[model samples]
Target chain A: MESNTVISIQNLVKRFPVGGDFFTALKNVDLKLHKGEFTGLIGPSGSGKTTLLNIIGGLDSASEGTVRVLDQSLDNTTHNERAKLRRKYMGFIFQSYNLLPVYTVFENIELPLILNKIDQANRIKRVNQAIEWVGLTNKRNSKPNMLSGGECQRTAIARALVHEPVLVMADEPTANLDAENSHNIMRILTKLNNELDTSFVFATHDEKIMGYLKRIIRLEDGNIINDKKIKKEDV
Target chain B: MLFKIALKNLLGAKLRTFLNVFVTAISFFMIIFMTGLYDGMRQHAKQVTIDTEIAGGAYWHPLYDPMEPILFEDSHSTLPQDIRSLVEKNKAVPILVSQAAIYPNGRIMPVIMKGIDPGQNIVNMPTNTLNNNKDINIPVLIGKGMANNAKLNVGDSFTIRWLDSDGTYDADEGTVVHIMDTENFKLDIGHIWIPIKKAQEMLAMKDEVTYVSYAIGEKKVKKSDGWIHRDVNYLIQDIEAAIEADKPSIQIMFTILLSLAAMGIFNAQVLSIFRRGKEIGTLMALGMTRAKVVGLFTLEGGINAILASALTVFPFGIILWWTAKHGVPMPMDYTEMGFMIAKRLMPIYSFGLIITTTILVFSIVIIVSYLPSRRIAKMKPTDALRGKTGI
Candidate 1:
């Protein structure tokens, strides 16, 4: 219940209907994320890491829980409201990068701003700044297909930050990249976190990713097995 | 931006996109072609009747009763001497003439021979009546088909063979002074025009006439005077009514065919939407609203319709013009009705038909786009990203 807490979840449960039967994806998950915190949710396959991340990001609804982000209750928000909230306060980076292949890097970065109805001139300025921050200004006009994996991920990060959101939810963002590209993306995310004071919540199973995060929450069979915080001194 | 993305996606799958456009274009082409034929037939039917201004007291078949049909036996049906005075007294009436069909060479090739005074013939015939170039002689004008079938030219001599009321064959040979280049009222291939005196002589009739025709001063006249203005329109209506009555079943068959073509267009659009399911899902996941997506597809459909329409116009226009100029010749049997069928069919360009077809095409595209776009819009972002198929 700290004043800096950006997301708070209580007994969150998500069940998806499969073959006409309900399958539990998340079981009574509880978590708290503070502003500017670099958190990782690490779990094996079918361990509810993605379901938990989706619920927090407003991309999916929890079957039962009290989910609050930026003082807004997800349980009662309309689809539009959730969309607007996500646009204003949250950004998402998917495992596939999801950069609109038809758009240039700059346009892809400017997408979230455009969705939020930001003026074109201001969007251009913010997008350029975000590109520069991610060290991808040189490739601003390149399409996602033309860029390398690390560059694509950098564009994704630029898109995530262009709207100046408070939090970024990345679901297995590094799952499709090589080790070197993964390291580069993590470095970019860490740098953005430090410079902009933006919080990041990652759902990942990579041990290398867990070692770099300020906190790690491990899940097993849809339940959190351990929630550990690492101090700056430990790293 | 969304349009750019959609276009890029469309272009990315070059083969698939080409196939879609090809199928759509073919369907549209066939639809336009079939509809054009119908339009051409309608125009051909209208032109003969609507374009010509015939100056005569109109004659109607018995059923329509637009005019009285006077059967010419000998000279009995001829106007009484006082009838000419009566026609002349009325300033509204002009020259009066009579006409009838004579079965020549049996019933297959009936020759239309009218009993017209040379001076009165000028008023009874259409403005562009065929005349002997040499001496302005009132000779029989044969249609192209009749001329071709009988191997008779403008100067050739042919005999008119008809059975008198006494059931005897009467024959007379006259020079083919003029051949009508124009299509007749019925759009039949064969037509024969002759001077009233010569026609009476050939048919062995004395002072008989089939029906009386007189010109009115003005183009517009009230039908209340018991005499219908003898104009090209009446001729056309007479022919059309006759043909329509003759082939009532054909019109119904064409209507059904047209309706089926329309349904084919609708089905094509629906199949196109179903085929692009993944692409629609991707677009929705990109935060495009259902309305915007629908607009995009509708625009695409409009583009296709316009392109297809343009593609169809040129060939159709040329074909129609050709048919209008060089009419088709029907068999000699149909000539008895004064039918001059065009060799080529000319389509009537109707804005209503084009607009209706365009709207139908667009609506089908929209209807097809609707369910998919709505389903995509309602999809969960995570589910869309996972590439879940929309049922």
Candidate 2:
């Protein structure tokens, strides 16, 4: 357990029961992520990238292995403890930009702070900062139904970062976005990661998205075939 | 904060919330109306009986049984002096009842002959009509119901034949002097009233009366030997038993109303659990526990009922207020049906009735709201996140 290691997975195995026999999603997968690392689980579909990402995000548990997030043992922690851990230290960005359809952009951004039970004054301040960071302050009153894909994804990013979590997990964040909006979203994530020193792990197979990552962990058929740090010159 | 979130959700699902709340509010208004109607009818009937028949209380002979009109010939005992003194002071009346046969327009019908003091003002009866200051034939008082049944009007003559104390049959011609409308069927159907002395002589039961009904003026009457002192409640016991007997029928009405309301809410909640899987998963992913999600949905459903209550209270209030102030005329004449109900009954609503109805409707709505939400607790956040659960 290094001081900088926020996520540590060892011999992690995840199996889903298909009919009667089990289908292995991840087999003895091992990974470690440090503070401020912009990493991507680069793999094709059914390659266990999302499965590993879910285990690291504390949304799912390893079937037969040890996993740690923010130095807390994931296998031993209760669901409530994991929820609290997610609330206090983790942020998530789904591929579909799962913004609450009824709430305004401002309200969606304020949701995480509300969940953390932060006082109104502090919540307003943080929400305003997050909204500005995503450049959606002008559209703060717009509900998700009226927002464009780019705006929705940006609002999703603001919601994820509003509480200033220690880690952010994104799953196919650019899947529904145009190439331009995809790059725009990637740039925002990169800026937030660099400026806030918050670690990020994105499960994306898009090469364009992978180009923005500082490290790429290529997974193939439930195994990590390649793990390497990208050089600034690689971009 | 939880309430605010729930309020927001309820407000968001406009149609679903509206239908459930409307149904719930319908149940609320119905229960209140029904109980109030029953209560109002009972209260009015009881008061009418007190005014016309049983004033405050009555003293009945131990052997007297009003239900068995045939036994009235043997049921009378001498009125107690305490009651006789009250009658002398115009605070009581000695009533003698006998069974007789009447022939009107060649139509022979059974009648329960009643005797009352023509001068008594203690009861609300129009017995003064029995005076018939200058009439030659025996004057009698009949209720509108009996007059209608017998086709007898004022000044119309009929023959009444009955057995005397010696078991001999006697016939007399009686002229109807007045026809009164009373709420009590006992005084209306097949009943005729004559002067107490005339009835006593006709029945050959001299110095004996069936019972002495008196107005004691809030003072309790002491039970005397050979007499049964019936209080106000005891006097209305038959009515209470009638209402009590109708309670299960009333309960069925409530059950149907509540069940329909519950079914509406249940349908909405089941749909919500299935349709809002992604939203629920998002909330769970945003650090809301499965319990909180259930609470939020349940609270939302409860708020639906409360909102419906708010929306309906004013409209229903006006309706109840109108019914209470004016009255609701019966669709059919209840008097002819042989039931004791006023022609136009003014509904009486009580604070307890409204509150109890609200509590019951809200309780049922909340319980209906929660059962479907329990399924939310079993959904896995990951599967719900993908909108793949509860399909």
Candidate 3:
């Protein structure tokens, strides 16, 4: 284990049973994420990027490999321990900006903090701050149905970051948004990652999302074919 | 936070939430209302009997079985000195009961004849009508139920035939001096009332009575060899037992209404799981345990019960209050059907009834809500995140 490594994966393999046979989703995948890095698992639809993201996020168990997240081994942790790990150290964003439709934007952002059992006065203060961070202050009381695509995506970002998790995993977070909303979301996400010194990992196929990544791991089918770092001045 | 979210969800789907809560509220209201109404009827029946047939207590001839009219011919004794003293004080009424056939409109109708004193206030009856000064004809009082059945009216004349103590058949014509209405059908159905002395002369059994009915304040009826002391509670025991026997059926009816309410809540819970799959998965991904998700859904369902209680208390309470204050009228004469019910009933809502109903309904809502939410524990977060429903 490296001192600064927050996520380390080695010889990882995930197999699913289909029609009494096995379909491998990831094979001998090796990856490492250091602190404060903005990274993307870049791949096409069948490239197993989301599968690896799900595994690293503790949403799925690894079948035949070692994976460690935030210094906790994914292979040995119990289901509840994995849940606690996610609650304390990880946050997730999804493709469709899955904000609870019945909840207001402020409430959606407050959910993670509430799950952590933060006190009411501080919870309200943090929620308002997160609302400002996502630039949805004017739309704080609006529900998901009342918000535009960019606003909804901003609310999802606010929800994911409200608890100040060490690692944020987003699976195609801007898939449903137009190009303008997509760029706006990436700018806020990048600014948060740089300013807070938090690690970010995204699973995406979009060229636009790839533009913001400092490190890109390219996946072909079930294998990682290329890993590269982009300098800030290169863009 | 979970409760707030649950409440917001319920408020969001306004119509679905309302239908479930309305059905449950109605069940809650009706369950308490029906039981209270039935209890009220029982109470009314006991009170009316206390006022009419059993005034505190009575002394009955040991051989007298009110059911067996054949034994009434021998179920009598000469009045004792203590009983005579009570009669003098107007605290006891000696009734000589005999079975007779009346010729009314040329149709023979068998009836029970009770002779009560005109001046005695031991029981509530229209026996005062026996004071009519019609010397040529024996004046008798009849209830409206009997009058309706026999087509007899006040001032009408009829022939009554009875067998005297010597086993001789005697016949005479009597005039109907009053037609009274009462709450106790046992006092009215197939019965007629006349003066005790006139009954003694008519039956040729002087100074003999079937039973000595003590007034409201009378006690210490001396036990004779042929009479038994029956307490007031013992006199009304049959009615109390009959009312007790009807309770299980009433519970079953309320259980059914509660089931309807439970089913409504259960259906809503199931639909919520199916419809809100994405929301559930999002919560799971946001670090909520599956149990907490289940708790959130169950809490939502429980909120329905609380809301239903809030929604129903005032309106149903108003109806119950109005019914209690001003008795609710029955479409038909209840006492006439021999049900021991009054024409108007004031429902008695006991504290026990309301508490039990609330507990039963709230418990069912919680259980049914949790039943459907259990599927969340079995749901794979990845699939749920994709908005899939097990398929």
Candidate 4:
């Protein structure tokens, strides 16, 4: 564990009771995420990268373990408390872009802020800034379907960051994009991490994405096979 | 924002939305139309009671009893002079009345020929009068129905024929001094009016009246006594009892028809809910609470019912106006009373019916959407994103 550790997971275990028997999804997973880090969670299908990310993000519960983020113990909170924690401290980007199709780019970005009950004047200021941050100010009023794959992904990222959460989670964020769009999304995520000191945890299998991250955690069969940090100077 | 999303989803599948709207509209229309018809009947019945002035729990006899014929002779069933004086002495009694009959053509075709006392009958027959010169000749006030049937106008002369005590018929011609609009026409089939005094002379029955009507004041009286003056409730009960005896089959058929119409509305709403399952699911998945999803569908149901009610009101209004203006004719005879009992019972449209049906349809929609919305709301985001389960 590093001195700047923003997230710490200890002996995290998740199991599903399927057909009168227990099926383990994550086996005693342990990991640490440091501040201002661009981290990649890499694994094959059923490797439990998504499961671990979900548990750490407070989107799902671990059957056994102590997971701590921003000094809040995930194991000690109620479901509503966990949801509130997710809303305030963590933001999520899905592979499908998950932008509510009925909303324009601006409204999608403003959703999390609205849920937090931020006033209209401040909400508009923050949302406009976010739209500009994602370089989509020109397309703020456009619906998700009107945007290309790369723009939609950027909109998702803008939504994640609009509330200024301490941690941002991306689950296979580039899976639906073309190679060019994928590279563009990675660049946007990397740049935001470097400039704003926001921590990003990405669950992905893209090899090209791995090169941009300072830390890479690889899982095999729900067990961490490799955990390594690359110095920014080396990159 | 969620509402906007819901509206968009509602509009997404144009054909399905149209189907829901159409079903709602038709159900609404049928419900409204049936209600209007009921109101019209009630209005018609009320008008018949008012126009005929059949007060004190009495309706005009449906047809003259064979044992008690209402003949032009005016000698039969006449109220004696002493009885009239006895009626007037009772302070609780408001009016004591008698009528006479005349047949213009000696035939049994339904007609009204009222012969009321100029002094005693002035309250009920407020418009009765002599010709302008105040002569003793009884002026005739004809109902529109009679005037139309006989093709006679004001000041027209017509012949009256009657059966004598010897079973031979006699005839006399008279002039129609007045023609009446339908609203004022109390006679149900066809009718004519004449002065009671003259009627007695023509029928050769001295100091005798055909029938008696009395308006009793509020003082309590013996319930089962054979007084002509009776309360409205008693009158209605008598009419209902008579109708039950005479037309039981018609009553049964009307009940069945009303039940079928109600069932049609119920079935239409049920089918609408079944068809909109996916649309409801989509609304719930878009972060709408289960209550809101149910509310939207309920609102849709209420909207349909209200629209239908509004649409039905106009046509029903026209029918009511027609009934009010033109009395409905009875097929049977009511010659002695000088008017047929028009079924002038108009329907009364009320806010309560609208509110009740709205709530009923809304509840149906809410109950129908409950389980479906809950199932959709509980689905995982991944499953929903994949459009699995088609919602």
Best by DockQ: 3
Whichever of 1 and 3 has more lDDT, that candidate is 3
lDDT, candidates in the order shown: 0.64, 0.85, 0.85, 0.61
Candidate 2: global Cα-lDDT?
A: 0.85
lDDT ranking, high to low: 3, 2, 1, 4
lDDT of 3 by residue, B36-110 (tens): 887788899989999988996888878788889999999988877776677778788889999998999899999
- Indicate the fraction of true inter-chain contacts that candidate 1 also forms: 0.18
lDDT (Cα, tens digit) per residue for candidate 1, span A1-235 = 5779999999999999999899999999888999999999999999999988888877789999899998888999876677667768888887877776657898778777776778878988999899988899789888888998888888888888888789898988899899988888898899889988999999999876776799999999899999999998887
Model 4 misplaced regions, further than 4 Å: A1-4, A17-22, B1-37, B52-76, B80-227, B231-233, B237-348, B358-375, B379-391
lDDT of 1 at A54: 80
Q: On residues A1-235, what C-alpha lDDT tens digit does candidate 3 reach at each position?
A: 8888999999999998899999899999999999999999999998999999999988888889899998889999876788888888888888889888878898888888888999889999999999998898899989899999889888988888989999999999888888988999999999999988889999999898888999999998889999999898866
* Cα-based TM-score, every candidate: 0.75, 0.89, 0.91, 0.63
- lDDT score for residue B67 of model 4: 33
Residue B322, model 2: Cα distance from true site in angstroms: 3.7
As for DockQ, the candidate ahead, 2 or 3, is 3
For candidate 1, the per-residue lDDT at A146 reads: 95
Worst 10 residues of 1 chain A by lDDT: A78-87
Cα-based lDDT at residue A24, candidate 1: 96
In angstroms, the error of model 4 at B286 is 12
The TM-score obtained by model 1 is 0.75
- Using TM-score as the yardstick, the better of models 1 and 3 is 3
